[model samples]
Target: MLLVVEDDQAFAGILKNLSHEMGFQVLLAGTAEEALSLARDLTPSAIILDVGLPDQSGLSVLDRLKRNVHTRHIPIHVVSAGDHAQTALSLGAVGYMLKPVRREQVAEVLAKLEARLEQRMHRVLIVEDDERQRDAVSKLLASDDTETVTAGTAAECLELLRTQTFDCMVLDLSLPDTSGYALLETLSQQDAYSFPPVIVYTGRELSADDELRLRRYSKSIIIKGAKSPERLLDEVTLFLHQVVAELPEQQQNMIRQARNRDALLEGRRILVVEDDVRNVYALTNILEPRGALVEIARNGKEALERLATSQLHRELAVDLVLMDVMMPVMDGLTATRAIRENPAWAKLPIIALTAKAMPDDQQRCIEAGASDYMAKPLDVEKLLSLVRVWMPK
Candidate 1:
């Protein structure tokens, strides 16, 4: 099934006709809202998105789809009038096409989607220094349709990658011959080797710097622990686009439990400090459904007062804060530093939100004591993912 999101009636008709010629059942969405609803309800095999939508940008729609566990594995191709190809691809769209597209271009995109849907086998590379650990992961992820390849060092991993392409790679940061960090850097510098979506599954305790570095090279990072195996299965299956229902009952249960942990926001209190009522409303809509108690603060000064009062009245304790950077009375950066200075709020997670997504802006937010940073206009799914990752576990 192919879901087409386009407000332009003529263009949508053209897309529908082309898709039918390829023997794909077509579902059309005239607005972003409709697209999101159909996607969440039907879980289409692939999506063809347009940038111009009545309610929201197509890029945000793409962001939300990729963040959602059920919809993340589905391939998406963007057809836009704007030059947002880079952004769309970064958000996980498989391919991007500009407006005034040729028939061959659309056909090519559909062909690629067909190939992905028809491919029966998925190859995975497990790169771990310990032979026992490598073998164990291979066994755990083993399936009738999956081919698992193992490497005990960075050199061997690189050698395998140079010759053959893989669907995904499960990497460990600790390698005997070279560190995982070095290997990733090597891959980034060289263009000959195939670099697949890497899941960094390791036992190494990582510092903030280490994590930030790894985020550049890896798709998901799982620290070895009691529930690590289940989480690994969940991530691997997602990247492989495997059919969960077809898997063994035991693996299915593991995937279910791993996904259930995403409900970390349930019953948690989040303080949303923003001057804009529109943003406040949007955040509320996203968080409240997840069972999070949403509290609003007009500005940075109001946020500080609320925190102070919450501390004085233990019953009002907030689990996390979504601080908007640009605000009257007091900016979020100032508020974040003040909160960090307070001994009582030392462990509280503060995520800084800003309209500017520039590198320097991110650096400033980090320097001001923000636990993390996100750019506006907010991507609903990414915001939820960040909240889950930063919220107290």
Candidate 2:
């Protein structure tokens, strides 16, 4: 059963016809009040919600439904002509589709909903060298609808991933045979294995460079602490899309406490070192709205000058540097080496950006003391994620 919540009768009819072709029993609601009533009265498999409504806003309805324990488990996909995709996603919507959508796009959303609803058990893989820690984490995440598999090394983890499918993976950086970074790199290349969203749960604190490397493959990083278990549980359930109502009361409370995302880049200062004006504009656009102060340096020589000037003024000290690999005067590699040479800026985080993401380029960046490397034609979301990860706490 699928709930179709829309004010437009014509479009609702079209959605119903399409759903019928896919063998779904559709229930219609023309307004926010009716939709809420229908949702509470009958819990459907999934919901297709519109942002606009006659009496109230659909985003309000979404928030209400997601907050309620009874209906929070039902996946909601928001369909709107407005630009509310980011807001909808943050509010727990499974997906978002802009209006004037093609039939194929709607069908894709339906297919995803169907796939999620059809899954019976969510499997999680725990890869940790410490036997006691692995068992404890497994016990903490264990549930009736969840199955957990434990592996002691990268080899064992790779074998299990090749043989079976999993919803998520909890990894530790330290392993006897191989590091977690290597395992992730291997998984990215092999198409034979079922790659799952990874949560890096480790006892050790990561350096800026190490953290940058891990960000390429891991979805969330959890350093072990008194409150880490709660956060780990929250992230796992989010990825699994488990029902909050079905979880134990204590677990639910812990999850609630850890659900808030940190404002990583707020009030932070980032120096963008690029010769290209277009990249400078793009980077500024992405960072400024997130409450970051962006400073630009046209070339490597100018970057050095900026750093030197900042050293004399504490208020102008840059928190991070986005270094373009190729520049007119003294390239990114040289700038990075020069930065490393200075004792004051030795540990400063500098992420090198290159047009080519080949192995040679990545190695060159690392050799030049870059904290990490990102390829050109950047993925906007991924770039943001990396920035958040590297941002100093």
Candidate 3:
């Protein structure tokens, strides 16, 4: 759901039409007061806030929302005809879409807004012993322009869970008050409602049994290393996306159908093989929610094995494969070569998921038997259009 707060009636109508066309449920307001009242009454997934409102400035409203406990986390995309992009961003707006907004631009902004909301809507509690590390992780989640709450220790995290709700958690294995595994065990004993998804983000190395045990309770486990902040963010995003993307297709369809009944997809399967967990998770999260069954393989070898073993491949029911280039245990190029060697899988639609945006890289993937190529950090909206093109009605 999105809330559009704009004073101009005609412009508001235009936004509504575009939002509906792009498959978004929109709530409109002509004044800041009305916007605030509606927001207080019913929380929205995202807000497209105009800088100029009749009653008050949008910045003031944004500040109010940030200060309030109830609405602080709802993502806001500030739209303005004026030159206040820097101001909006500095004030904590997720995105600033400039005005005289083109249909394409609006679509792009809304698409990003939806992605940001989807990532954070499932709340995750962060439990870290180090204040600095805890702060850093909190900023990363909030920096993507999403909502997240943090706790410095396991005790605080458990207390937060007792009073509030969360979609998942990022637990540091080494905590001052208690070990991350202990918290996981306690949460598992509780019912599913009290048990949010857990992701272990710790520096500690574990035995295979410990890793398996953590997986039994948590969604994913990440080892904190000397990886760059960007890499860490990617891992976190990947973990969150996987958890949310697991929702039933009917539930996802309901979200789409509520916004636009015309939104339809006759079930299509897209197999994405990417070494980077973040890319795979983000892409899968977006695609699965749109009525596509997404199958993920960590590396090229795993992908090949799945292609050989899956019943769908035997029937030629697998629609597409989004193959990543650089991976362990056989890169995409080698995997594609192996696939082409086989008569049965030679004609499968393969698309390269490459970080190399260069023209030569695209040509290489295509030469390796990929039908097409998409750059890394896949945009949710563009990928949807590409899927529609390949899987035509």
- Candidate 1, residues 1-393: lDDT per residue as tens digits? 999999999989999999999999999999977999999999999999998786556776786776566787888899988776644654556778989999899999999999999989999999998888889899989898999999999999999999999988898887899888899998887998998877778775556577678767534443433337887888788667676777788888988877655335666899999999999999998899766899999999999999999988876899999999999999999999999999989889899999987768877988999977888999876688667656754
Which regions of candidate 3 deviate over 4 angstroms? 120-393
Candidate No. with top TM-score? 1
lDDT of 2 by residue, 325-350 (tens): 99997899999999999999987989
User: How many residue pairs of model 2 clash at the backbone?
Assistant: 0
Rank the models by TM-score, top first: 1, 2, 3
Instruction: Name the regions of candidate 2 deviating beyond 4 angstroms.
Output: 5-13, 27-42, 49-68, 77-102, 204-227, 248-393
TM-scores, each model vs. reference: 0.64, 0.54, 0.34
Model 2: colliding residue pairs: none
- TM-score result, candidate 3: 0.34
Question: Candidate 2: global Cα-lDDT?
Answer: 0.82
Give the alpha-carbon lDDT of every model.
Answer: 0.83, 0.82, 0.68
Collision count of model 1: 0
Across 219-278, the per-residue lDDT of candidate 3 in tens digits comes to 344443332344344334443432213444543333333322112233567788888877
Instruction: Name the lDDT value of residue 180 in candidate 3.
Output: 77
Candidate 1 weakest lDDT stretch, 10 residues:
218-227
